[model samples]
Target: MDNIGKRIKHIRKINNMIQTEFAGLIGIGQGTLSEIEQGKLKPSIDTLYELSKHFQIDLNWLVMGAFECMNLKEYEYELLRKTRELDLDCQNEVAEFIEFK
Candidate 1:
């Protein structure tokens, strides 16, 4: 999706959640969620962060479509966490290995 609203809506739909249910999960009102999905209102940073944390969404993709919507498995999430602990050079090496493989 090109816009944050669309992306949010896509996430909800893909997860089989209605506005009320999804809004409740993210601590938002159904009306506010509707407004956001309609692009009539922008989501606050707190809302974005909640969405990212709750859904394991990639903020980059949610904000700018910079990456795929990454719903990582548990092991994948652990791998990412471990990779992030590495120094920049080691991170680059890991990335290169992944890319090459």
Candidate 2:
């Protein structure tokens, strides 16, 4: 797999999300996501942001494979990951808390 594909695959696997499910979450087709993972296709910026936001991955890491992009705290990453599993209201509460902080 290519760099981007490798990172995408790693994030998805670590999150325990299947390609079809992940694709659906990202508003992409399963086939498109599969092709992306195979390095046969490049995802759009919107798609990249969707994946990054949903998976709580660094956008630079997702786009440029930059592991050193940001020094994110483990708890911060955990919070981001868990937030995706929350319902909209719960997520809004978390967002509001962050904003208030």
Candidate 3:
């Protein structure tokens, strides 16, 4: 998607809501909704929060077209993957120690 408008449109279609219904749900006029989807208008942060909550969408995905993956550097993902292999009790202990530190 080129911008937030396209992402919003994609989400609306995927949720099976037309402009009128989606606008009603989001508490905006259909004309305004159309303008937003057409890129003539940008949605405010409050509108974005409403959309995210109503649709169970990740806000990062809505605003940016992709989930903000874990901000961890390369080694972190590998470390976490290995950490998951530990027994549950051990994992909890490790987690507790990490928090304590």
Which prediction has the highest lDDT against the true structure? 1
Q: Write the residue-wise lDDT of candidate 3 on 55-89 in tens digits.
A: 66667657765532545543553356457668899
Candidate 3 clashing pairs, residues 3+ apart or interchain: none
TM-score of each: 0.66, 0.65, 0.63
Poorest lDDT segment (10 consecutive residues) of candidate 3: 66-75
Give residue 8's lDDT in candidate 1 (0 to 100). Answer: 91
lDDT of each: 0.83, 0.79, 0.76
**What TM-score should be assigned to candidate 2?**
0.65
Query: Who wins the TM-score comparison?
Result: 1
Better of 1 and 2 by TM-score: 1
Candidate 2 lDDT over 12-95, as tens digits, reads 887899999989999999999999888889889999989877767778767875543456554555566679779999999988
Candidate 1: tens digits of C-alpha lDDT, residues 1-101: 56889989987986799999999999999999999999999999999999988877778868876554455553564477458668899999999999999
Query: What TM-score would you give candidate 1 relative to the actual structure?
Result: 0.66
Sort by TM-score, best first: 1, 2, 3
C-alpha RMSD of each candidate structure in angstroms = 7.3, 5.7, 9.3
